[model samples]
Target: MQKLIRRREANPGVDWAEGGLHPLLARVYTGRGVAAPDELELGLGHLVLPDKLLHADRAAILLADALAADKHILIVGDYDADGATSTALAVSVLRDFGCRHVSYLVPNRFEYGYGLTPEIVELAITNGSPDIIVTVDNGISSIEGVAAARDAGIRTLITDHHLAGTTLPDAEVIVNPNQPGCEFPSKNLAGVGVIFYIMLALRAELRRRDWFAGRKEPNLSQYADLVALGTVADVVPLDRNNRILVAAGLQRIRKSQARPGIMALLEVASRSPHNVVASDLGFAVGPRINAAGRLDDISVGIECLLQHDHAAARALAAELHQKNQDRRLIEADMQQQALQLLDQITVETESAPVAMTLYQPDWHQGVIGILASRIKDRLHRPTIAFADGDAGEIKGSARSIPGIHIRDILDAVATRHPGMILKFGGHAMAAGLSIPRDAYAAFHDAFVAEVELHAEEVMLQAVIESDGELAPDDFNLELASALRFAGPWGQHFPEPVFDGVFDIINQRLVGEKHLKLVLSHPDSAQLLDVIAFNIDPQEWPNQTLSRVHLAYRLDVNEFRGRRSVQLVAEHLSAAE
Candidate 1:
């Protein structure tokens, strides 16, 4: 069972209220570390300066010089949504800047894996012997690839956001916000955001040279939509700086001034661009673009975003939509199989480990990350799911609870047992590694031991933090709508979820594992609509209980031209 802990909601927001923030918004903002009302003003003017990033200005000078010399710039991108959008943004923006020699190549994940690998560099060379290589969203950890590029007489500029390794790449210029000496306050920039900053710096460099003297200077804000899409899709924390970037992009999408590819994606997802929100990017748009990379080539997604023709964009978006559906079906089957495997292991012991690991040779390598995430959520433990990799190695994707630093655990395991982990890279909560097939047992033991060394009792249990029950006055369509569209919420800046006790007036199973119910306040006669998805049927069978406590978010459900406030119950517990 999950534990629900009420957040200590603060009401001492006099300064915030004086700054013209709504009273409710003030408390909500303060609860989430927002001290002043001005902090919530996510305008383009609020963005952090690009020069603050270490070496960013230098990187900009290098790129500007390359462009001035009319050097062939081949973009090397990772095969993911962030990489795809970053690649598209680079290609589109460079072309808009009147550079005809700009192009991109996203490595086939199955063949080349991630980053600008030596093989990928050769493939890039085979495709075209570009004079310069501009890596978007990758290449920070590519020690060999950078060397290979240099040997081939190609200059390199890497604009990545992933954490840098102990040793940096030998590139012409590196513009990662998370690099060792970077004092960039907002280090959580997505790859797209990093490139966007580089673009900003490049524009300043060009302006210094009077490059726009005879040409129309491209307003880079036009690419903000791509930045927003990639930022949200990558699930990066929406700091004040990231929020400004995302909000600017969201404004463009709402105004129907989004790129043709984004419009096409919205169309396929059945979302109106006029009403698109940040959540739509994560749940709807990101998945479709990711499907191409997971199931096929990421080039499809990049090409879809690059197309200026509305019809062509729509057609590619439709194909991408179908691929997403196929991905979902495959993911469902894999999840079920994973659960079965877990059952077999825990069935005998009747208990699960603090660190769980599973391997399936037939699993699709591209989908293992999502699979690991799902299983981690289910078990409420650090989990790793493995798939077959090239050679005799098995690639593993890992996901962890907030308390467990998965990448650290991998490093520890590798240190404790040498020649075990061939290679690994990732952030705090998610990571990827490869191990020899014959050493799976040793690797699993080392990994689990490291997790046990780090797992605390509090970390092992799942705790759902919630804002205490909303008053009847707070439960209205206005508040719901305001909360939904007031600003871009993601990662650290979460949408509000309130907890309360309600009388179960009526309940019925709608779709598989979903419950539709009519809920009523215990002391009020007013009725409310509630939809609980993926709820275990055994937990709310026939709704025999008269009342129950629920942790839910206020959602605005719209149909046709009508809209209503609905409660989306995320968690439930017995009433006190």
Candidate 2:
């Protein structure tokens, strides 16, 4: 493990004391271009009203027309946490807005594949005969599918947060903040956030038209919990706009007034919504939602979110809980298999490049991305994992390291060997693709060549960023709460990492492979339990009283009736 501490300089334009922010926080905010106290405002008043978002009014008009005409409306959602939440939000909001003939469909990873494909559109037609289709979390990449929907005389509204392709789809309304030429400041809004914004706009439009004269004007903010869950799960950068969304959702969650499904899911996870934090959403709630998509159809997750009856919601939540556990088991097995294959290949001796491509006929297509991520973390290389699918096609997922763009590599491969790849799209760090099984070898060669051209730019070392050292006094519960409530933390705005040198006072294995340690500084000792998951004890330092440096995040762990702040170590190494 490599320790890299980058000291951030403060900006003179901001007053840290007035904002009630720590010095380190001020430095990080300044580095992230946050200038003044006003920039940190997180009140609902600061959120971008739905009317301000692009195409929101148009989407509302389209939905209103569909509702008046009693035309069937089908929602097409992606198969992920964000997509599941977006689908639920859309269904819940649309039903509240008097849309009666509405249903949702999520593409299966093993069957119809990802996004709004032609097959999915055909399935929607067969299932609902939808006169209009609304796509959540996906559709910006579905040029052909959009055309197909148009051919079927179905109006389409795309609500997505993914980067747009070169050619925009021919949808009636495109509400993506990341779309080209959109001046939305918070381009990092999740797909669910985008849909929620659309709902806000729709409600406003209804109010303007006096459409709420007899019925109640739905408070769209009530769905903020769903927005927060999706935004955190999607791993988008939590910008100012997203922070407000998550903060609002956290407020609702803390009140325990969230939807029955959300409440039930929290209960199933043994987490109290009244005390829910961002970490709970990311690790606990998000994974359960994503499990439905990864291991089975995501409709189960959407149902869990949209079901109104408490008993039904509880049952669904329990089902999703079991699915998430099954997903973990599958992921662990696949990761081990991938590692075994990687061990056979001498990455250092390979002259072509350090890029990795693995294929297993028995691998589950839904979990390939997780397996790819695991391999990439261990090897520190751009990795792609493929599984055989129906009709001789191979579905693959790619994960990239810091300096390598997996999507760009895929694009290069497609450009060099046109028609070799069936389809592919994603951001810099992650991507998905499908190819004919016979073309895998050629695609693999081209991908490796592309990665080799950029290999020097990719740093394979695990560099840990930290805020130096601090005393045990700084580990108060109040400080932990302050860190938790400071602002939304995610991909770009990372949670604070801390580092310190300590003596290993005690060590033992807990829960099979996890190592628990009691560490001590020069002045004080703390009972720190470190869980190096799946790590062998023999690989750790053997000296009984060795000095070691640790990079970790501070977390408040609650067990039984006790609450204590603990350091969750990311990396540990013997001191030089």
Candidate 3:
């Protein structure tokens, strides 16, 4: 799968430099659609007011009432990083507000599956006969689960960020920006972000009721660390609102004011809290937390976040780190098997299917999502990886290329084929579903047809967007450091990448799969240090190549207390 590089179109009309942005950073931000200076402001005051989120006030009132009446409040959470953070955030904040009998239950992915299912509801009842059930990061589609709780004489408040279905859950109050007719400006809130907003509203409600006269008011901004981790971990778009949350969170972590769990996770990942960034959270800490949910129960992660003792948090972090290591081994094996399966199918560019679906009966259910994502990126097509489920069922995790709404495609398949898919729900780029084990072939064909019906030719082609090229002057440490921190970038707001032709002064292999190189521009004699990670072992360190075109990021590499500019190559190819 060869890729095409396309530079983003810059907005020339916006005077980014006039807004006090560095020339290089100004150009990068302009390419990402930053039209005004205020958009760059990431202070807590710039966050969208909680009043705009539909039913946030009502939900706050509900939770406040529960607290006022000393009712048992139980949080139903999903089994992912966002869910863990949301559950922890809700529990910590409510308890900080002096609410007694606050507990939570996260459904294990293996036994109870996702969301608040009826089985999970029964489990929750047996676990902690609660008076009010607060669902964080889930329950938007748990129609049956909410009904069960309602029939059990329990009140339910649903706070989720996933796309709502045709019929909303019958919970007592729902707080989601994507819900019908919601006026909240940003709809890209992760599950954790939704719960964060609800907590803020709850604080306000409590404040208005004079409930904080004798109690210390929890500064919700302090919890931004959790919000930041969840927002980046869930891979939500970094819209201005989300950027504010992430920026605030990064500020706290950088000052070492983050919670014990975050600090402990960072320590395990070898990231310094004094200079932590959004990517550090997304790549290093987030994965360790998510590994708990993937390989075991998510309670390990939630407990780590809620723990006030540093030693206990570190112990949980170590466990999560081990789980992550195990997940990597399992994922590597599954990916190899998937690659072997792909080799058996069409290999030609033109003849290959627009969508790919692979299944192995022995594949670990916890890792199918990652396998699907890897295949989707490798082949630049919508991909789904399936693993054996209960008795006669097979569970699939789907990852889609751009321009294809995977969840909608699943919906179409379910709408047309009726019983082929048992249940499905997700956002545009990813989804999950289940079907009879015997119906694998039929479901695969139906899925391919639906994808082909919706996919465009260009959509199937892998393309990398670049921020154009950098000049010799731009290859300095100041600009690199500025660009690095200029963004809490993720998803929609991408980090800056540039492409240019460079002379390969020297090349060598480092750390087995990475390539280290010294390169210089044709016009400039100054050589630049470059490194590309996870390169193809069979094709790298080509001694015959004199010049190459490289897509890379200007990064500052620090070694032995020394920092210098280094280009991190994302893609490289021979140049004419």
Candidate 4:
């Protein structure tokens, strides 16, 4: 492992001390390019209102007319955590806004694959016979499917957050931050965030037209909890706009007024809503929703989010909790098998570049993407995994290192072998594709060739940024809580990681592979509990008195009836 310390510096356009932030916060904000005190304030007033978002008013108008006519409206959602949450948010808010005939359909990873495929569009037509279709977290890449919807006399409204293609989809109202002509400042809004903005605009339009004169206009802000859950879960950059959404949602969650489903999920995960943080969403709630998509039908997740009844939501949350457990077991088995396959491929003598492509006749298709991620992390190389699909076809998911773009690599393969890949689309880091089983070798070779052109790029050392060293005084509960509330942190705006040198006073193995260590810093003579999850026991140092460097994030761990600060160790090494 390589460690490079990069100092945080103020952006050229930003003022640090004059930004009216706490000293530490000012440093972090300026490092992230915040120029004014207004950028640091997370008040809802700072949020980009619906009208400020381009094409949002037009989308609201289109939706209002559809609702007035009582036309059937179908929501097409992606099969991931963000997609599920976006689907539920749109369906619930639309119904709350007086849309009489609103329903949702999520594509099965096994059958319909991903995104707004022509097959999925046809499925929606057959099942719901909708007059209009709204896509969430998907459809930006569904050029053919949008055309098909038009041909079927269905108006398409796409609300997605994915990177747009060269040719935009022919939707009646396209609400995407990544669209070429769109000038939305925050390009990191999750799919759920985009849908939430549309709801805000729709509500505004209803009020302007006196559509809800007699009835109460639903407080659309109530759904920010869902937005926060989806945005953090989707791993989008926590830009200024996204931070406002998450901060507002976290306030609702802490007040215990979050959606019943989110509350029930909190119960199942043993996390208190009153103390919910971004980590809770990423670890506890996000995985449960993602488990439904990875192992079973994602509708289970959507139901958990949409079911307003407490009893029903609890039961569904429990079911999803169990599904997540089962998913862990399945993923463990697949990962082991993948490792074994890697061991069998002997390429030591060959100068062929290292790129991973694995296909299994029995592997579950839904979990291939996750398995690809696991393999990529382990080997530090671009990885793709495929599983047998219907009628001798194979479905594959690919994940890439920081430098290589997975979708571009797949596109190059497509160009090399015309008509070989059935369908493929995604962003730079992750992608999905399908091909006949017989063409797997050709596709794999083409991908390897493309990756070889960027070998130096892929082999670059990893850069790990730290928030500098922390004294034992900084480990207090007050400082930890302040760090937690410093604003939403994910992807780009990273959660603060601290590094320090310590002596291991005590050590033990706990819960199979976890290492529990008592580390003491000499500066203040303070001892801290450090837990390294899934660490290899053989790698533990033999000398207890030896100095060691540790990289970790401070977390408040609650056990039994007590709460205390602990170090969640990410990496560690013996001090030179």
Candidate 5:
């Protein structure tokens, strides 16, 4: 059973309802730590300055010197959407700033693995023979890769956002908000955001040097859309600083001021840039870009983002769309098989699960992370899913509930059982690990014990938090549209969900899986349309239903140029 609780509210020092905020949304923002009306200001001017990030100015100087000296610059990027966007942003901004010879390389997850491996360095040497190498979204733990680059006489600068390990890399300069001693207010910048800041500082440095004496400095604000895409796709917390970046970026996308590549991606997904939301970035475009890196090289994704021609970008976007479809098919099959495995485990245990570690030799490594996340959501427990790695080893991806710090759990398990875990690193919610295939038993036991030790029994139980029932005044389209544009919601700052009893007027299935219903409001004569995607037939009957409390968010669904308010139902239970 799932428990529902209303979030606690805080005073934001104003009459929010009277200050142009919908009453429903005022409480929602207040619950999320907003203290005043100005906190919701998402204008670009409200963004935290780049200089607050440590080493940002130094990184700028390094890049400016390279451009002035006509040195070849190579960007080493990880194979993910954040890395793809970072590389694309760097390449685009550098070229625009008169850096004539600049290129990028992303390690193939299958061959070179992640980060700047020695093998990747060798490949980079053979391909570009760069004078300086810039690492984007990776290289925080790449001790050997930096060494290899140094040995090959290449200067290296590291710009990343991941938490650092015990020892830092020996790069010439490092700029990570999470790095030790950095007082950047927002440590939540995605890899792409970090690189974009560096670009901003680099532009300032160039201006200070009078490098643009005769030529105009390209406006770097044009790249904020890509920054927003990567920030949302990377799933970093939407702190106020990050919200500013995303809000500014969304404004550009909505204004059709986004780049050709971003525009093409929106086209392929059948999304209007004018109406694009943060969810669209994370769910639609992110997956398509990530699909290329997961199943193939990320060059295709980077090329798509870097392409200036609309037609060429569309061609690449189409290719990415096909890859995303293929990825979803693989993910669905794996999920089904995993559920079957879970059934066997449940049968053996006959008790509620606290945690789970599942492995299938044939499972795709690229997809295991997504699978782990799914299992964690369903079971409401810390979950680790392993895909076959090198011979005698497995690559495990983990996801955790709110109360459990997954990375700490892994560290403790590894500490207790040395060599049981070969290698691991990640943040609080997610992490990656490697272990011998034969060590699955020990790994599973250790993980379960650690999860139980760290999390309370109540946390293990499935619980859903609601923003409470909506008032009669909240049922209008004006309120729905206002709520939608309240702010760019993500991660820590969640979209609002409210519960209310509704009488089902008409119900039908759409696309063979979705439950589409017309609901009547409890306190009014208004009829609301709702769609619950991928709901089980058993959970929702074909017969018309009445008096069910629905936890849903307000949505605006458009069809054939006609726009109407729609309720996107998340959970439904019999009204008490």
Candidate 6:
């Protein structure tokens, strides 16, 4: 698919340069809607007060009561990275606060699907027989599951960050920022962030009750590491509050103050804790833990996070690392198959469909989300990939582009054509659903029509937003290093990317698929190192092209203790 490198519009209201920011960075920050200098402050004090989160205090009261009464507490967690981190954070903190009977159960995706399903509730009862069920990272839509727990005489507290459906679950307390009537300023809290806030509120409740007079109080900041990992892994918007959480977590991880599990995972992923950043957590550490949930069982991930011993955590990290490797292989095979299907479909149509729905009976259920995401990025269309589910149904993982809310589309489909979609829930960019296998054609048509109705024609095309071009002097190492750390950037708050034309002094293939090149700008004679990962093998090494336009990020490449400026290419094409 073709891509357009468009520069972001500068925000005229904010003057970051006057606020003591680097001129180049000032422009970049202002372009991202930084209205004031204080917005860049990522301290813990800048985080939104926990009191503002709806039902958080109520949930805290329930947890404090459970702790004081020595009630058995069972945590129901989802099976992804966010769920694993949320469960580990909740279990670790509650235990640290002296809850002896607290334990967690993450439903296997293969057996019970998602959320606090009735089956999961029964499993929790058979296993832990708890007095209170605390759901972390999920349960916003588990209406029947909460009812089942209630019937079994167990109270439930739901802490989640997913967008709530029209009918909320009947849990005893719900602490989601996105829930109706909530006043939490930042609605983009990831599941782990929500639970962390609840724990913070719980600590305050315990403090108010004078429960910490004799017992040592746990520093909630210690769990910020977990919050950071989950928040980034889940790809939530990095608003001011989330940035604080992630920054604090990165600080702890860099200082080696994080838990053994995180350190062990970083070690296995060859990421030194001293230089860890949000992207490392997103691409490296998060994936290893998520691999267990995707391929085998998420308990391995939860257990890894819960480990206090370095050796034990390392063992589990190694196992998770293997799972991640297996998951990559599976994802690669599935992506190839999906692309082939897309090719056939394209040949039969005048233009690619505005939305895509793909199904293959043999596709791995665990890898469909990634496949959907890959296809969505490749074609710049809303894409859903389905894998065979139980009996006559198929499960799909959907990924969407900007300006197209996937969950809303799914909701519309469900509303317009009842029973076409069995169930669905998620955020703007991603969602999951199930439907009858026989309804694939009809659902595909309905989904495409919905997307066409809601999405603008411009959004259907791939547009790579850049921070414009860099000046000759701006391409130095000092600026590159500054830009690298200027952000714990991800999702809504993007890392800076720039577009410019460059003369290709050298070009070759590295690692078979990656393109490595030495290039010089027309305005400067100094050559810079550049590399583009996962480039098309057939198109690259084009000795035919001497000049090219590149959309790239200024990156600092460190090789054997030597650091230099490097350009990480986002998009490259022949310069007209």
Which sections of candidate 1 miss by over 4 Å?
Answer: 11-14, 347-351
TM-scores, one per candidate: 0.98, 0.94, 0.99, 0.93, 0.96, 0.98
Question: Model 3: which residue pairs collide?
Answer: none
Backbone clashes, candidate 3: 0
* Residue 336 error, candidate 6, Å: 1.2
lDDT of 6 by residue, 1-576 (tens): 568889999887775656778878888898888888888889898889999999899999999999999999999999999999999999999999999999999989988999999998899888868999999999999999999999999999999999988898888999999999999999999999999999999999999999889889998999999999999999999988899999999999989999999999999999889988899999999999889998979999999999999999999999999999999999999998888987876632226778888899999999899999998888888999999998999999999999999999999999999999998899999999999999999999999999989978788779899999998888888898889888889989999999999999999999989999999989998898999999988899899999999999999999999999999999999999
* Tens digits of per-residue lDDT for model 5, 129-159: 9999999999898889999999999999999
Please report, in order, the local distance difference test score of every candidate based on alpha carbons.
0.87, 0.82, 0.92, 0.84, 0.88, 0.92
Q: Between 2 and 6, whose lDDT is larger?
A: 6
Clashes of 1: 0
List candidate 5 segments past 4 Å from native. Answer: 1-5, 8-13, 347-350, 542-545
Q: Model 3, which residues run further than 4 Å from truth?
A: 348-350
**Which pairs clash in the backbone of model 1?**
none
Off by over 4 Å in 6: 347-350
Candidate 4 lDDT over residue span 156-264, tens digit each: 9999987776788888989988888788888888999999998888888888889998887898779989999999998887888898999888999999989899999
Residue 487 of candidate 4: its Cα lDDT?
A: 66
The pairs that clash in candidate 4 are none
Off by over 4 Å in 2: 1-13, 22-33, 348-352, 525-531
What's the count of clashing pairs in each model shown?
0, 0, 0, 0, 0, 0
lDDT comparing candidate 6 with the true structure:
0.92
Q: Model 1, residue 82: what's the lDDT?
A: 95
The positional error of residue 366 in candidate 5, measured at the CA in angstroms, is 1.1
Q: Model 2, range 251-329, lDDT digits (tens) per residue?
A: 9988877888889888989987877877788989988988998888899999989988999999999999999999999
Residue lDDT tens for model 3, 1-576: 567899999888886656777877878888999988778988899889999999999999998998899999999998889999999999999999999899999988888889988898898889878999999888989999999999888889999998989999998999999999899999999999999999999999998999999878989998999999999999999999999999999999999999999999999999989878889989999999989998988999999999999999999999999999999999999999998998888555566798989999999998999999998888888999999988899999999988999999999999999999998999899899999999999999999999989988998878889999888888888898888888988999998999999999999999999999999998899999999998887889998899999999999998999999999998899886
Arrange candidates by lDDT, highest first: which order? 6, 3, 5, 1, 4, 2
